[model samples]
Target: MGFTQADYEKFRILRVTHVAKRFDELIADESNDALLPEQLFLTAADDALAERAANRIERAVKAAGFPIPGASIAEVDYRDGRNLNPVAIGRIAATDWAMTVRNLLLISPTGGGKTYLACAIGMAACHNGHQVAYMRMDQLARRLTIARGDVIAHQKLLSDLAGVDLLIVDDFLTVAIDSEAASDLFSILADREHRAATIIASQTGPAQWAIDLPDKVAGDSIVNRIANNGRAIQIGGVDMRQVRSHEVADAL
Candidate 1:
């Protein structure tokens, strides 16, 4: 059977996923027109600037070595962040530590692509030559607990977090924050302020974060401080898991 238009459309969309070339190339009108629907690719390819942002998000992710494939600025949801309204769809291209001191908050349920967007931005910052790091809340907590094996080890872990240009904590708020962990997080955020940017991807939004955390009073204070420094992007839509599974099952 020949591939139908629907098939081709799906294929093309899938092909572009996480594929970042020259951000300009996605929309460039060149002799390459014969290869594709230049019209569509032109509109939706990738949106990035020529220079890299000096955010260490990717460095953090890399050092931690989470299994993320690649990152891109395009993966972010414009309408979801603390801003409430969508910035020009591709306007995130202009966001960087230098340009706006504002931070990013990605709040959503599982499989909502929050991590993808965070990693993409981190990757972009890395491409621009900024240091980056990624740590899940659980992982950070685990590292802290383990570091207790040596007094120096605990300080080193905190130092690693404090020095980065960008940081992403995925699955943040998964557990209630104990005083030890809460104090550590507060210190990290406080240390990174203005000098570095951090992205938090949490199942709980700022409102619920206080409740999810074990130290409600301290957690509330910490969240408020982070909010003071960043913007929250809440993603809402149908759950993508069942849909993707259905697609694969139907194909099989």
Candidate 2:
């Protein structure tokens, strides 16, 4: 029978309490969720358990001072029967990447899922409880230049970047690096060396990145550090961006 308004409040509270207790009990046994006979009998806020899982991952990554995923993010595809170095992921997760001082370079000819792969790795790093930050190099450079007018603010921004556990430089060398920015980049890399991991995604390979900086010495320095005992993941083949666009066009 439907309860009166006052009775409803009492029943609702009791029901909530019961659900809370159940959640506490079942949370420890995640696999037992399927044994729950009726969905309605379960607490309305049952998602608390799942949310906790996500939160645990988020918290762990944050404590590392890294960038985790936002509201919407997904892994890149490598097609059926294919994986994007799951074994490496296992090693990376178990290993303390924050201390590895290694870097990842994704070399693809644009739209070949370079950015997506970098993002996926970042997400995995977060899940494995590492801190991660992600940004396209061009965008970061652009923003840095724009924010230069505010010295107090700009320094803070650079400092903040230095604190993350993993820094993802997406589309690295997308644009030429100037003298000032090259110095800044070098300092950032130096500070992060042996203290964090870096994921660099770029259409151009390291050898082809001569356009990154005007000063050969400064440019070479940055390149040397990146390739210094670092891991490189070459994402070759046709541009996925063009392939997808062509398919869409053909469909139309």
In terms of lDDT, the poorest run of 10 residues in model 1 is: 46-55
Model 2 residue 126 lDDT score: 74
Please report, as a residue range, the 10-residue window in candidate 2 with the lowest summed lDDT: 64-73
Cα RMSD, each candidate: 12.9, 7.3
- For candidate 1, write residues 105-137 as lDDT tens digits: 878787776777677766665655556678888
- Cα lDDT of all candidates, in order? 0.66, 0.67
lDDT of 2: 0.67
TM-score of each model, in listed order: 0.66, 0.67
Q: Distance from true position, residue 10, model 1, in Å?
A: 54
lDDT of 1: 0.66
lDDT per residue as tens, model 2, 83-145: 356566546545566667778787877567776566666667777667667777777787788
